[model samples]
Target chain A: MSANEEAARHREVRNAWALSAPALILLLVAAIGPLFIMLVYSFLTPGQYGNVEWKFSWDAWIGTLYSRDIFDGTLKLADAHLTIFWRSVKLSLLTTIITFIVGFPTAWFIATRSPRSRALWLFLITIPFWTNLLIRTFAINEIIRNEGLINSVLMWMGVIDQPINMIYTDTAVFVGMTYVYLPLMVLPLFASIDRFDMRLLEAGYDLYASRWQVLRRVIVPIVRPGIVAGSILVFIPALGAYVTPRILGGGKNMMIGNFIELQFGQGRNWPLGAALSVLLLIVVTIALMFYVRASTKGTNNG
Target chain B: MTTDVAVEARNAVKAFGQGETAVRALDDVSIQIRKAEFFTLLGPSGCGKTTLLRLIAGFETPTSGQILLDGKDITNDPPNKRPVNTVFQSYALFPHLSVAQNIAFGLEMLGRPRAEITKTVERMLALVKLEAMAGRKTSQLSGGQQQRVALARALAPQPKVLLLDEPLSALDYKLRKEMQLELKRLQTETGITFIFVTHDQEEALTMSDRIAVMSAGHIQQIGGPREIYTRPVNRFVADFIGETNFLSGEAGEGRVTLASGDVVQVEGAEGRKGKVTVVIRPEQVRLAEAGAAETIPATVESLVYFGTDTHCHLRLKDGTEMVARLQSPASGEAGLQQGQSVGLRFAPGAARVLED
Candidate 1:
């Protein structure tokens, strides 16, 4: 090629590299690099100066495999961790199921409305998202506290002789997590249900299917992918929730998140905390992968 | 007294909106569809043909009317309760179901015995020539296959009346023509009343035993395709059903005088003593050699040739443009060229007086 053509090719290559470098760097720093560090920490042992010791050993894995901490009262065993993990899973699952029950109908209702009404409903649902997460959590905490509005109302109505302790429980964690993640669940559900072809429902009606039969056979299958996506959005974050559980749950109903934070902060065991974080990551990844694969199969079958 | 009367709508009226803002979609319209015949509702868009079909299918309630199927009023029934099924314009096949499942859907809805449903579904698949594709998914099927699946699914239950709303409009020209023949055969074989809605006049003309031509929420004419086409009652039906050349004229007594001073006897227009339109088809205009006797003097304005025939556009001395289709080399070479002076004539009964 001529000199100018060669020069143009070089410029094109350089410009392409320049445009893609930032995103590549971001992926490496935010995802690949942290994962690599976590893998190394999973193998390392903690040193005296609150740092990881440079060594290659199966000590942390073995420590995780066996029940040393629970025996010595320094840390908890598999049962404690497993119990916490199961509780987290159950809470997150409940949140997802409840969110779908509340959100699907709301999304379908909004989607079926006129465009003006749809916009107003979407705006109302999104308004809570504009507030800071901390403020929203604190607001819920105040509303459901022992001396808060709910207890006060019950006292005035003579429904209770004493104020009910509503906050600082697993129920409080669920309420707070659901409130925080309700919008995240709703938007995707709305999008998927909006894309549903309304004519298919009419076809179902013409075929002699009752109203509920149409819902089961037509509407639900068509919106299954959205349900899966929305559940993942709600469940994954609810599993690893720290602030909501910490504030609304206080210290009584400490979830796996609080346990991990305790290992890293008060326990001063870097490797153990990293190990717990890694375990949480694996559980979430597996659940999400299974959900995605199943929902994809559902979409294809449809 | 009339066991053959399959569907009857009495003074059906459907209005949109409410009160003063309302627009009448079906204005006191009534139609009777007999059993074992192909009836077509032909009209332009916004003419309420599809609305009328939906009313029969029980998808929409008439503002004020009675819809009877087999001597029982079904106007208050929901779609699922009615004895009718519709093949939608978009097909509306269950996207999640296979071809067999889609066809078997209606049978399943009827709470039929499983073995009987299977037999009927298989029979329908064979009827639509889609037996081989029954195992395939609906989304994987081609448009023609989907069309056949929709047809089979609607027919499987053997509804009292089958309503098709522009079912063949989505297919290509060749497939549409093929489906038209297949549908006629299917109707005859099954002996079911078919009420089909279409805006294409050729489709109505080719497939229907009778046609109801509608315009502006009213039935302008209803008869056999030939009767509706050849004996249209108004200018809209004349222009809508086929191409027509309109000549403005003044009518008094039994004769109408064209602007060119040619007077023709138009029966049934005796009392119309004001401005009127005389409608004539282009093919009805006969071309003659220059200076031919009893022919109006005209000049060819344009010539368009097809493989089978040639169309000659002419302007009379009074500047009224007309077109004539000439077939064969002898007829085409009757000395006609652009801007060439010629003569034009029509038989006495060819043109009809019309009101808009």
Candidate 2:
């Protein structure tokens, strides 16, 4: 509008940028820089030994979906690659759903405790986090293994002649992932449910809604942001999870993370590894975008 | 159990926490709300007015009593099973729903036909005069509009009775007055037995057809607005309903002898003796020149100038303090001075005697 006001506004913008410059520079160097390097390598040629070459090629990107035969040089669909991708997506979705089923009631319980004991309940929820993730995964392995506690107790009771072969399978991975990612779901759900107005329950009941209807129609809709947050928190990490699948799946079953790691280590294809890593990042980004959309829509309607 | 009685609470006692720490919130209270009447539970906070209302709504079960709806026992029925709804103190409209959806919620829960629900929601929106805000979220509304949506939502189900739990307390003064009239009109138009709960005496006096004055978990009195204001049965009801002067004296033959050797006529002291309390409303006391006939001599203590009336604070010879509301002249003050001698006269049949 005026020259003085314009100058002052310009100074404010400059000051804001100056204040944020450090964080912006750190993000670029620490986070986006490696991702940019991976993107560039995905477009380049793969070397004989385990790195990218200067020469450019689309072999790595093409190899992601279609594998070229070594002798015939004929292209065909990469069934193994497709299977790993499908398993990754499926297991991650199941993990999200299972964690939600177990976590919603847990969060509700913790949120409904009296003020003095609510803190204790929340502390108990986070007790598993005190230990390392790998250690916890191993602890789970100890229980469901062939000679683990469950099998030993059942065998001692003479109910089964043989121990169940639960280890080294998809079920093992699912159990381990659900165990590991459950707190992720519960914490956000707790945060939302704790802020929920208990009086709305009375209002819902007064409105002729059954208890089931109240939960589905009132409580779930109000706490939906927590559901979305918890789902994202579990789903994105579960999609690209490496440690649990590696330990629990026992090398026979592999997810996208192990497959990507195999390309760089044993397969010696750095470009393909980079391409797969970038693809996983894209999937996580899309999930986060949906989260943003859903959360914003929730607030707008709420 | 009469057909005219829409809801009845028979000797209801509600206690919170047990084993010696128990506090009786409603101590063996009984009340009958007639059909299509605007009955109010009025008292200060912790007087168990809300507890009584909750008992009727089936939110809180009585410890050892029965609640009835049209002569049917509903004591053990849950809130949802009862054909009643509540407009909460906070106007607890669902935040995620539009105004129209909030109104349609009860009908949908009751499994009404889709067309009927649509029609009822439309009519409710018009009843509260929020037709344009049907699509707006409850959070997007102002306090008064949210209040209307709460009303519409509760009324949409067409319950036999509507329980309002201090619903107007959240509104501002101007809006509270507007909604008071709006609530009265809604009750009249719907012809639903409205059980309203409030602490504000003025609100209860203005809106309710019958007021139940409560104190310390007991129903002190229940009567029409005029009856409760003019003919309170006890000191608590008289002091609680409005501003009043309480004078302790000996009563006999329709006359009271004050402690300071003055005599005054009280209407209800006939054939009574010994100690009693005289209840006289401020507006019923008229100030006149000193030493007038059939008057009590008093000294002016202070004068508060209200826009419509001037409150004259006075002290009697027996050290009893009293207030008289004098109408201010249109163009001037009431012309009363502090510390001046005056005579106080009670209007004919204005004073009632209560047991001390």
Candidate 3:
């Protein structure tokens, strides 16, 4: 290459890096810096009063799946910790599924509205976001509690003499997370469905495809990117959700987020908390990788 | 109930919206398409041609009338329940499916066996001459290839009747012409009843066995191409099919007297009374020297030279403007100029009289 061309190319590369330097520095300081600290803490010894010491040890990582008997120091399965992890993964998966079931039709309805009124329907979907997430979770807490609107209405109508116990259960946590993460699922679905060609439905019907076949074969495959985006958006945050479970499940239905908080705040095991936090990050990264694979496959086929 | 009639629409009316703001999209339209014939619904946009085609395809149900397939009342049948397919104006091939898969779609939906669907898909690919493109996605194909895939997909199931709603309108001029002939060849080879909808008059004339010219939700006329072109029943059909000169005249006793005081014989003016519109095609009018026998005096307004023909714009003495298309000479000259006086001669029995 000519020297002039090489010099000009080097200047362009320098300008690009110079423009991005601020973002790169901010990311290193504000994001990865704390994760580095957590990683280091996960390898160190936990102090007595909820802090980590400089001495390296593997006890915190081992304690993630096992705990020692206080008397004999025998390593055994961490039953309580495993239950919390299972509940976290299970509830998060169910929340993703339930949100999709409810959000698909809602997004389809909003996307099919008249152009002027479609804006109104989409605005209504996002109205829940204007309120604080904590307040919203608490509001759900009021509705499903023993004296909540559903039980009150059922009792008033004489359908049942006693209120069904729905609070402080896994069901309550499930309901709460689904409500909290529903809009996240719906918006991406709407963005994809809004661009969907309605004429394909007619074309499908003309081609002898029933409505159900059309949905499965045509609509679902075409809008899969939205499904993946919405799933990841709901799944990752729901896996790490804390406030909704705390408010609705009372004290027993602890998710991973609440369990990790317990290590730092009251359990006095900072290193274990750091390790659990790192584990959650790994789970999220794996989920993101699956999403990337799925979306790329969809593009390749299309 | 005749076996030759493939599809019949009886007084179909389709209205959009309700009450005060309702728009009548198809107004009491009735048509009978014969078996294995290419029938065209030709009109300008919003003229209800597409609506009629949709009614035949069962995409739109009639509001107050009946649609029949082989004497069976199919007005209430859903599109998927009917044995008919449509090639949409947009050629809405599923972008996710490969070319072969697209052709196999309708067959698969019909619950055809795997081996049969594969055989039919291969045959359809060969029919449309796209065998080499079977593995490619619909989005990867060119416009013409996508169009062929759409045709193959719609033709795979061997529907009793096929509907095409301006399928070639998206193509360029050259490709549109090529597909027109290609579509005709497909229809002939398959011997399927083809119901085509388009607004281009030349396309309808070139490709259809019969043409139904529509206007404002009404069928103006229905006949073969030659009949519709040479013998339109009214002014709308005459003006829409091609260029025509409408001269205000009074008709009686096998001849018509123009407002310019010139008398000319009209083919269909026999036994007609006063106040008629004379329909004369541009190609039927011949220009001669001024004051020739049986010729009307006119002044040449302008001339437009197309490759094969020269359009002579002329004005009658009564101030009525008319156009005459004359064959361009081999020497590349029309031998006519503006503002020159000329005699306009109508070939014997060239004019048809329409009631005013």
Local accuracy of candidate 2 as per-residue lDDT tens digits, B1-356: 13399999999999999989999999999999999999999999999999998998888989998999999999999999999999999988888888899999999999999999999999999999999999998999999999999999999999999999999998899999999999999999999999999999999999999999999999999999999999999999999999999999998767899876789877877899999999899999998899989888999999999988999999999898999988998886678899999988986499888999
Locate the minimum summed-lDDT window of 10 residues in model 2 chain B: B1-10
lDDT for A4 in candidate 3 is 100
For each of the candidates, what fraction of the native contacts does it recover?
0.64, 0.89, 0.87
Screening candidate 2 with a backbone cut-off below 3 angstroms (N, C-alpha, C), the clashing residue pairs are none
Model 1 chain A: worst 10 consecutive residues (lDDT sum) = A62-71
lDDT of 3 by residue, B242-349 (tens): 999999999877888999999998888889999999999999999899988889999999999898999999999989999999999999988888999999888657
Residue A207 accuracy (lDDT) in model 2? 93
Candidate 2 backbone clash number: 0
Q: Model 1: per-residue lDDT, tens digit, B1-356?
A: 23488999899999999999999999999888888779999999999998899899888899999999988999999999988899999999987788998888888877899999989988999999998998898999888889989999999999988999999998999999999999999998988889999999999999999999998889999999888888888888998998888988899877788888877665656788888998888888888887888777889999888868788888877889888877748555645668998777778678788863
| Tens digits of lDDT, candidate 2, A40-89 | 99999888998879888889899999999989999999999999898899
Between 1 and 2, whose lDDT is larger? Answer: 2
Off by over 4 Å in 1: A1-21, A43-79, A114-120, A156-161, A298-302, B1-3, B248-254, B266-277, B289-294, B328-334, B340-342
Task: Report the CA-based lDDT of candidate 1 relative to the real structure.
Answer: 0.86
**Model 2 docking grade:** medium
Candidates ranked by lDDT: 3, 2, 1
Each candidate's TM vs. the true structure?
0.89, 0.96, 0.96
